[model samples]
Target: MDGQICCMVMRVNLDCNSCCRKMRRNILNMKEIEKHLIEKQQNRVSVCGRFKPADVAIKLRKKMNRRVEILEIEELPVHYEAEQEAPIVNHYKYY
Candidate 1:
């Protein structure tokens, strides 16, 4: 029972139009993870939802022709509107 976890995480800072570009870049990083696969050790890849579109995982698995483990997908919250910060007032209250 080896407790070591061997995996690669691809993190992308998302903006408006960068989603598509990040996805393509993340796909290429999969090959980098594959390079770490040696002997009996297992190498895995982790990608966020923004990096993966529909059916991308399926395509990656078929392309790699190897077993890929999908971990739990976490859903993040969306904040529609945020309140503006109040003006900062500095004073010696206890003076």
Candidate 2:
């Protein structure tokens, strides 16, 4: 195996117009889940992702229940193609 390590990103379904509240909730959940896995599996990992608030991470680490060390935090933008939608919809089926 190569010396480099691989990391996984939680899948979040959202569009450009998604509400801020929803986005925040998804990000928080991602971090919490990843942290739990790190503790359970005892794997060394560093989490770097965009759109995550520092305060939320700090608060979660403070709990010290599942994690005692603050996992490495870095800001990196996550980009992927969102599911496409039909440009137009037919109303005949609605009747």
Candidate 3:
């Protein structure tokens, strides 16, 4: 990957169960997202992947048609592991 692996947290208006479900579906459909967590109580969503934070925010805004506020963005450390005859693998720890 060219860009750094990172985790982005955003505050969104998740009002009901349907809203949460919609958000989950959207996040799951995004190919660039490796993992995601939706905190309905906090009205926040955390997404981890190799992507530009701004780009993700824009995408969410357009897809959700709701206000999206970026709360935090942090770069994650990449760990490499390899087995005896296997290719190297990249791993990321999501916080």
Candidate number with greatest lDDT: 3
After superposition, the stretches of candidate 2 with alpha carbons farther than 4 Å from their true spots are 1-36, 43-53, 62-67, 78-95
Q: Which runs of model 3 end up more than 4 angstroms from their true locations?
A: 80-95
How high a TM-score does candidate 3 get?
0.78
Over 1-95, each residue of candidate 3 has an lDDT whose tens digit, in order, gives 43667889999999999999999988888888988999999999999888888888898899999999999998865552123237766797879
Question: Per-residue lDDT tens digits of candidate 2, residues 1-95?
Answer: 11222233322222333333433444357643333222223333234333244444454444322342443543322232122222566668654
lDDT of each: 0.39, 0.35, 0.86
Error of 3 at 6 (Å): 0.6
Give the Å shift of residue 48 in candidate 2. Answer: 6.5
Flag clash pairs in model 1: none
Q: What are the TM-scores, per candidate, against the unseen true structure? A: 0.34, 0.26, 0.78
Task: Mark the 10 consecutive residues where model 1 has the least summed lDDT.
Answer: 33-42
When 2 and 3 are scored with TM-score, the better candidate is 3
Quality of model 1 by C-alpha lDDT: 0.39
